[model samples]
Target: MLFGAESNLDLALALYDLGGVQFGDFDLGPTAGRSPIYLNPRVLISDPAVLRRIALLIHHEIQADQARRRPRLASFAAVAGVPMGGLHLATAYALVSDTPLLYVRPDSQQPSIEGRIIPGQTVLVIDDLMTGGTSLLRTAKALEESGLVVRDFIVLIDREQGGTERLHEHGYHVMPILRLRTMLTYYHECGLLDTARYRTVMDYLERTSPRRWSGSP
Candidate 1:
């Protein structure tokens, strides 16, 4: 158990049991999906060890980031987590990074006056997974409207579904603790998992993702 979480291998299994991450495809309805698995780590908030480990890992990464000083990690004015799913991550950031945390709401409150951008000093929106950039884009737009420039985003896993592409389109970068493909291969190599489930999930995500949308603007 890494910090009391189910063994990291087991954690992936538990995540798999919880229906994998659905990494990218959510709209295709089985017609033309690319991924066959999905992991909603947000669902794992209930497990104390998992939650604690996530927080600790964030701490470790931050320290490591500081150690590898090309630009030298700078203290964030604040940590902004994308709402709902990102809330827990924001709290962990607040505690570990000691940075104040705020989350952005997906919808604008009133257009001209209210949306208010979850008020923070400097934000790093957080989320558990990134499949389509839909949610992240929305969060960025809201924060931007509120005068906060969302520079970097942090996520537990990147389905690699174009979330990074979408964010780039909107001017934000993503940092994920685990990339789906790499993690899956790791588990498979360790014998923690076989390929059957991997194919199911990956295929499903690829097919149904926003990439299929035409004239979507």
Candidate 2:
């Protein structure tokens, strides 16, 4: 019922309406290439109420994970966010859950673990989306190098473009609030996405996802 959606389907639609999901041709980046759909959870910031709802949902997930005796996120000391997207999400989570926060700077003079982050402290890395797993891996490595332990990665959306599998293969765990397949299917079912665009996006996912998990080049 959070974000004024009665069900996950409704929530997905709400996200679509909120500009979190966009259709039509797009070039995510040189490396990301062309795609028919773009998911930007950052849009949620324009509507504080909606963003708060998402932050709350993420907080609940963290709490639930902690409740599990053997949960991977049960022992984190702070929330470390990947730059751009993860920063806001981490700020929200820290506010909602009163959890400590860790930031990894993009500049040369990165903060030391002794002051900013305690050495040997467990951390859960948060990000807005995972496309190729590069940012997540970089953030994890940065944290580890600074003496923080990173065992979990959480994101608002998983593009389902093999990023999750890649992280898993590297022995890092990932959690996503919504998946690309689920989002695209919901849009199609709701008539928000035309048949052509729907097929285009799904086809892209199919073509690209295999290479990631299959260990093929």
Candidate 3:
């Protein structure tokens, strides 16, 4: 794996220092009212060095997954990035992996097959973060309608907010590089997160999680 346990722990701490993960009251969405911890991957785009590192990490992980035959990553013929947030990440991955890149439209605004994807191509869909898998499902549907096969989905962070389960139910294998619960635990252990903030964020995640899913050990 590109980011082993120790390396991932360091990455989580680095992201915290980068102001990507913040503690405070913030809006999650219409359904999820308010949140104590907010995660934003867009900040990484501002720093080319960090963004390239992230892209390389993702590339290495994908290569490792392919080597291990984990969820059959080797079958992927192209990388499809869910629009708005995932485009840059996918671009970087393509640059590193020398894979074809496809940008899935956010909605049905464009022709289904207009992007860089070819019909009958197997694609691995990627996104920045997954909260409920709603956007990803939409993107996958569009890809399928365009005659592309999508079986695997990837995200930079999984909030453990039921998105993975939801995607699995739809027959899509989901891979998350970092999980919110794990990151929070690491932050707390390293003293990067205070006790009160840690408890509050943990409570909020537990309360808001659709299935109250805890990440893997």
Candidate 4:
């Protein structure tokens, strides 16, 4: 029911600006050649209060999801993050919920010998963005190989590029705090964003969206 509420969207947009998360003008090619509206949530670490606020946002979203998803992740065994990018956000969320923290490292080794490096509990994967969900999927695999279940993925943004859909299609539920469409629309409505700049991103995302909707890499 909270999916498209105006206040949640307003708060999300406010966080996007107040957190000072930079959005890139150039595409970063998770699409191989397309990229637009890059967001860096790492900036929140510089401000402890903002970091906590971000945590609160995540906590609220998780609470809502727990009450909603069947099999109920309310007592989720642990919180796990995809390496390098998702570590801090995962830590922040874990700190807020008083939940245990786990991490999925890049398995740069031969297949069978890659144990103890990935996650090992029913983990909730956190990341700032879900571009193609490459890292998320790999992390989930690593978790499973280590006898874990990754039932849910949470992200700060879901670029409207089917990242969210793909994750759900792959049998993992996705909870995104915000999507690019409403985000861009909110900023444009508030005059926080230039029309031309916003248009460029909207057009780019449209053109670069994957033709096949499968959640594969």
Clashes of each: 29, 0, 0, 1
Query: Best lDDT goes to which candidate?
Result: 3
lDDT of 3 at 173: 90
What digit string (tens of lDDT, one per residue) describes model 3 on residues 1-217? 3467676566676677789998788888874568887888877787787778778888777777777834455478888888778888888888888988887655556635445757888998899888889988988988898889999998988988788888989998988888999999988898888999999988887887776445443
TM-score of 1: 0.72
Models, CA RMSD each: 5.7, 3.1, 2.9, 4.8
Write down the TM-score for model 4: 0.78
In model 3, the runs with Cα more than 4 Å from the true position are 69-74, 107-114, 212-217
Please identify which of the two predictions, 2 or 3, would achieve the higher TM-score against the true structure. Answer: 3
By TM-score, the best candidate is 3
lDDT, each prediction: 0.64, 0.80, 0.81, 0.70
Ranking by lDDT: 3, 2, 4, 1
TM-score of each: 0.72, 0.87, 0.89, 0.78
lDDT of 2 by residue, 1-217 (tens): 4432244455566677888888778998864689877788787777787777777888877777788978866478799888878888888898998889887776657643323668888899999889989998988898898878988988888888878778989998998888889888887887888888889889888777856557777
Lowest lDDT 10-mer window, candidate 1?
111-120
Q: Residue-wise lDDT of candidate 1 within 1-217, one digit each (tens)?
A: 2432234445565566556544444443332244345466777777766677677776666666657856233446767666677778778767866776666544646423222244444566778777776777777676677777677777877777667777777667777777777677766777656678667655555454556543243
Q: Which stretches of candidate 2 lie over 4 Å from their true place?
A: 1-11, 109-115, 211-217
Query: Which ranges in model 1 have alpha carbons more than 4 Å from their true place?
Result: 1-14, 17-34, 72-75, 106-108, 111-120, 200-217
What does the lDDT read for residue 208 in candidate 2? Answer: 73
